[model samples]
Target: MLNEMRALTVSELTHQIKQQLEGTFFHCVVEGEISNIAFPASGHVYFSLKDSGASLRVVAWRTQAGKFRELLRQGEKVEIRGSITLYAPRGEYQLVANQVSPQGVGALYAAFEKLKNQLRLEGLFEPFHKKTIPAHPRKIGIITSQSAAALQDVLKTLRLHRPDIETVLYPSLVQGADAPASIVNALNIANTRAEVDVILLVRGGGSIEDLWAFNDEAVARAIFASTIPIISGIGHETDTTIADYVADLRAETPTMAAKLSAVSQDELRQALDLFEMRMTGVVREKVTKYRRYLHRLSLRLQAQQPAHFLKESRQTLGYLSEKLEHLMLKRLSCYQQQLTNYEARLNPRHLVGQQAMLLQQLSGLESRMADAVKRKQTQEEQRFEALVGRLNNLNPLAVLSRGYSAVKSGDQLISSVALVNQGDELTIVLSDGEVIARAETIIPHENSPHNKGI
Candidate 1:
């Protein structure tokens, strides 16, 4: 009976343990001081994360090890986010960390906390100092790195939600020592213009040091001093910064900040309803104010009529075009979101084909809309030119321009040479001037009536 039982080889036992460990500790975050940190010529990192009594082996592949290699000092505290796997050959369980962040990093953290507390004590975070955001802002100014994905995210959200709103970008450095000054300058410029109703200070999520620029004292003060309401969307939802507290509004992410700056379709519809009810009362109460406004508007309107007409017309078309395009893109993004959730389960080929087809459809639609706009503009120009042609045809000066003249004999138009006798007084009207002449001779044809002279 003992012979009937099978014995597990060393390889089999190791594989079974590896499966168990990987299944349970597939992903986790651990914090400890690094020790015996070794970076060999192969570029992989070998280290041990240990506290008082326990030590865990850690391995970082070349791709991720480079980012934190300089900070890999022995006994340095850090937080590692990775999965655990067993190296079957050595039968050792080690952490495979892809992200390593300094934990309560000695100087940077202390400095950050110090500044944050100082700002709070100064009442920079007070709610009373905050400016109210406009309900339906016509213009939104954005401050961030031009290359950041946060800018793209906010722009996409803005386009999707409010295609009619005008956007102005104030690109600046969102990292390093100079970032604070750059951000402050951008804020000052946006406020100086006093053109935009709101400003969004935003950037993507990053490590603490990478995001330290947003936590700067100068940036926080700039946000507090802004005349325009500022919405801070710096980093992920869990990340906290001093600028977020000093700003008028704090968004969980850059996308949410963009959402806050935009007026949704539902809000627009509700606003329209409320506007109608408020208009009558508002007009009655503000008659004098409106009269003065109208006087100023009349003067400006007279000067800007043609330009205003064209600008308004183009804005209407642009808004419509943007709305249509973004709505379609939003739907595609939804499909992409769904695909992302099932990307592992679905065939890659199928996903690629689906994306290609959608892109083709979108391109066709965009091309057609562009062509339509072009054709409409062309048709209007042609119609205007046709009207001008008809007007020219009815103009008497046009015939005169084409080498024609009129002869008047004694205040009566002379139609035939016979009517103009020799030495008759005649007034010849040319395009430029008039000539008064006494016909010296009259040449008449035999077939002409009364032997009319030519």
Candidate 2:
């Protein structure tokens, strides 16, 4: 039977198809690699899941995406469990994922865990095993794909930071199956040459599979054992590989690694200029201080010289000597005036004439005075001569010479008869002769009745 076709709106047709697909698909699990991941500020994740030739769009809202946010990354293999839904407004179909897990990890994760544990026991990730990055590298060797943007970025950054840095590039495969061996050989070559101060293993951002070479055990071990300090700058900011753990420094990008290994020339020049200015200021200050000190010392020296004082003292002595000489000359002139006045007061000629006249008058008076003095002298001379004649007549020697005999007893003369006694020795002197006589009887003076004198 021919039935009339019912008319339906475009919205109705789309709604009906969405409902039917939602009912038929239900919630299911799909495992594939992630591609074209896009995150917007709306807190929603948008990406595609793909196998060999097919891809399905996915949309995980913020509430459901929280669990898988850290685990989801570009090119990572994951299994997602979600409900199939069709957006009516956009007329597009997509999976609204509710949960996610790493693919093949049910069995592989156990083995990974077991190996990680075993390695932990062996101290493969010990901090003591980590090497130190050089502060100022003289030469930097780069291990990267020859055509990569990472190599160009690293070279540009090093030239900007330090133009004097020497850099060499060792080309290698950064992706695919052969990348790990290429990187390991590059590291070995860099170590053997000893020409580079530091080694940088770098590549641009890519999917996890593209960056897998850096996670290889051989590459990680080679990085750890490198003599030169190694810096890993692989993938994007969110990617972390096993090489990151072993490298001496892990930079987010190749440019950042170059900046970390070198210094800026402009900053160094500014510092040197400041230092030179400070040294000049210090030297100038010292010279000024010494100059002022020398000036003060010179003035002090001038004040202390003995020549000025000696000259002043000599001038003073000369003034005093002149004053003494003038005083002596004045006294001599006064003495000369006094001598002239005394000479005028005592005229020698006048005094001598007056003495001559007085001498004539005195001569006339001397005739009378001399006559009186002569008469007095004549009488005194006569008296003196008469006294002499009397003295001569009274002389005992003269009497003895006159033949008058003087009787004496020893040296004494007998003056009275009474002095004579009976039996006394007598000394008699007759003229020039002396005799000693002895008294025979007492004698008396004849003036009395006794006749002793007879």
Candidate 3:
């Protein structure tokens, strides 16, 4: 029976150990530095609790995770109240933490707070010192690890929001002892390049110790001194660093930083659509108004037509002709009356000489009267012809027929180049048709002759 000591499957053995450990350490306490913390979407928390000597795996269920997340940070000393248990799948023992309390702030966090306070006193974080982020950045400079998941997140978000936006990446270390220097060097390079509209200093979420480089004094100073607006996104939403405080804007995550840096293409496209609609409405309104005005003008022109004036002139001429005829008839009647009186007074001997002289004088008077009437009629006809010539010369249509054109901006005549600008739309009225044209260039005359006379 001793030699046949039973062989157990690995899974069975693991299960037994798990049961034994759970029974023995039904409750226990763990103190160590938290590291490699992860909070999954399921709301459970998984992390490593490490000391100088060794490390232990820890897991907190969703119920415990929610209560301790705010208090637990990477590299932070914490006391965990939980039970020891073996995980059969991994064949490892882990602490199932049900309660967690901070032992103290980590050294890196202490330094971060100290520098933040010092910078606050120095006014580095003052609103007045911060640069405003452009609403529509042309280019964004991202400073982070080339292979960082944070960079990928930022890139994906930016592409979704604004596919046309250009992004330039400055790769740098985001963790470890040399990370601070690398970040500072990257900042310097971005400043020297000076090509981006804004800078995004971002990194994936990590424990306090892993994100310590962002809390470095030199990196903070570099951010504070940057001319370009900086948006800092380091670690989780609950995590804060010195760089976050000094940056012009703070984003809880790299994805948020990408959004804050640029306006979405859809938003811009919608704005343009609205503007186009408004402009079209304005142009239509103007066209309607001008059409009404033109109609009124046509009516006025018809009312003052030369054909109507000519008709009135013809009526006046007819009235003058009647008056002339009446005057001539009256003169002839008077002559006849005088002739009759002379006949009544005639003697046989005196009548012969008197009749001959009177006949000659009568003929002369008649001839002079006819000549005066003919001259007056000729003068009237000549004056009418002159008036018709002047009217024809003043006709707008006549001018257009001479290869001259009239240009109008809206309904107003464009009399001078000063009234128009490059790219202005104009309606050119020609002899037979109209042409719509856009001004391509405007050349202002220097010491213009028109200005000189004025």
Best by TM-score: 3
Q: Count clashing residue pairs per candidate.
A: 1, 0, 0
TM-score of 2: 0.48
Residue range 150-199, candidate 2, lDDT tens digits: 99999888888888889989899999899989999999999999898888
Give lDDT: candidate 2, residue 380. 100
Expressed as tens digits, the lDDT of each residue in 1-454 for candidate 1 is: 9899899999999999999999999999899999998889999999999999899999999988876676678998998889999998788999999778798655676798899889989999888888898878989999999999999999999988888899999999999989989999999999999999999999998778888989888889888888899999999887788889999999999999999986786688788889977997788879978889999999988877988788888999999999999999999999999998797647788889889999999999999999999999999999999999999998878888899999999789998886777878899988888999999978777887777335
1 against 3, candidate with superior TM-score:
3
Which sections of candidate 2 miss by over 4 Å?
Answer: 1-121, 273-454
The residue ranges of model 3 lying beyond 4 angstroms of the native Cα positions read: 1-105, 315-454
**Cα TM-score per model:** 0.43, 0.48, 0.53
* Tens digit of per-residue lDDT, candidate 3, span 232-345: 989878778889999999999999999899878888999999999999999999999999999999999997899988998999999999999999999999999999988777
**In candidate 2, which residue pairs clash?**
none
What is the alpha-carbon lDDT for the whole of candidate 2? 0.84
- Candidate 2 residue 204 Cα shift, in angstroms, is 0.9
What is the C-alpha local distance difference test score of each model?
Answer: 0.90, 0.84, 0.89
| lDDT minimum window of 10 residues, candidate 3 | 445-454
Candidates sorted by TM-score, best first: 3, 2, 1
Q: List the residue pairs that clash in candidate 3.
A: none
